[model samples]
Target: MKRYRFEDLPDIIGELLLKMNSIEKLLLENKVNNVVADDDLLTISEAAKLLKLSVATIYTKVCRNEIPANKQGKRLYFYRGELLNWIKSGRIKTITEIQLETETKFNSKNIYK
Candidate 1:
């Protein structure tokens, strides 16, 4: 990060605040009901809507450690970006993809038959 001059600090902060307000306005206008802020830690209900799952299901996954979350006392919190990435990581491979992987494994010749 570049060091900022103390003299110019207020101007820089004001500009950042304006940009933040602009971004907030745009987000509100778009009506993005599921995920709102850039770094919002979501509640169980919010997480369920974002993931298209039920609140009970989210609780179940949290208990089973199948999903990523932070447990604070009795509360659960999830990061929106991380949850989206986790959902992406569970993608199913097609038949061709499985065949290609199998072929690659056999071609490597390092495995014991």
Candidate 2:
């Protein structure tokens, strides 16, 4: 079995969050409606738009507990602020490094020796 670490991915995810925050700020300064409401609650579609991710992916994250979300009766809602903070936490940072380590381990195996 191969183990993967989440710390291996670059800080690209953090950069992406900063970019998104910048866009949101610019939109607010330009009097364009921010994607998230003042209360910070967003529907799945709205969050997907803000994250530039597929709704299915968002739902998957929600299900996997990768993102913070709560159900209000039958409605599932996510908090924009929480989502942004979560992204800033760099959960994907380990991916690339873990993959590299696994590859190196497999290559170092003495299958021919």
Candidate 3:
């Protein structure tokens, strides 16, 4: 195999860092809970975004059994109801849902209602 020049190392490192940063950002923004539980499941990355925390922090909380999580194979999922309950239970201090929006029970049809 051919060796890469020392000058190219910086570019490679920069690209890797950029990719990592993007992944971090994606993990944060994808935490939205607009989808129905029957529609799709939220990943650990999404939970981090929803909670406005880092992915590593999410894993740490999961490992400590502080947050509600479901593990399937190599993937972990967070249910909307369980996550909300976890926040209400005060297990997760950073993840907060706006309770003042409406005082109504959420079914499969309307959550924000």
All models: lDDT?
0.90, 0.81, 0.76
lDDT of candidate 2 over 37-94, digit per residue (tens): 4348899899899889999998899889888888888777888877787878876647
Candidate 1 lDDT by residue in tens digits, 56-105: 99999988999999989999999987898898999999999999999998
TM-score on alpha carbons, each prediction: 0.61, 0.46, 0.45
Q: Considering TM-score, which of the candidate structures 1 and 2 is the better prediction for this target?
A: 1
Q: If ranked by lDDT, best first, what sequence of candidates would result?
A: 1, 2, 3
- Return the TM-score for candidate 1, rounded to 2 decimals: 0.61
Q: lDDT (0-100) at residue 11 of candidate 1?
A: 96
lDDT, candidate 1, equals 0.90
Off by over 4 Å in 2: 1-38, 91-113
RMSD of candidates 1 onward, in order: 11.8, 18.7, 16.3
Off by over 4 Å in 1: 1-38, 110-113
lDDT of 2 at 67: 83
What are the per-residue Cα lDDT tens digits for candidate 3 across 19-77?
A: 99999888766655344552456888888887788999999999998888899998899
TM-score of 3: 0.45
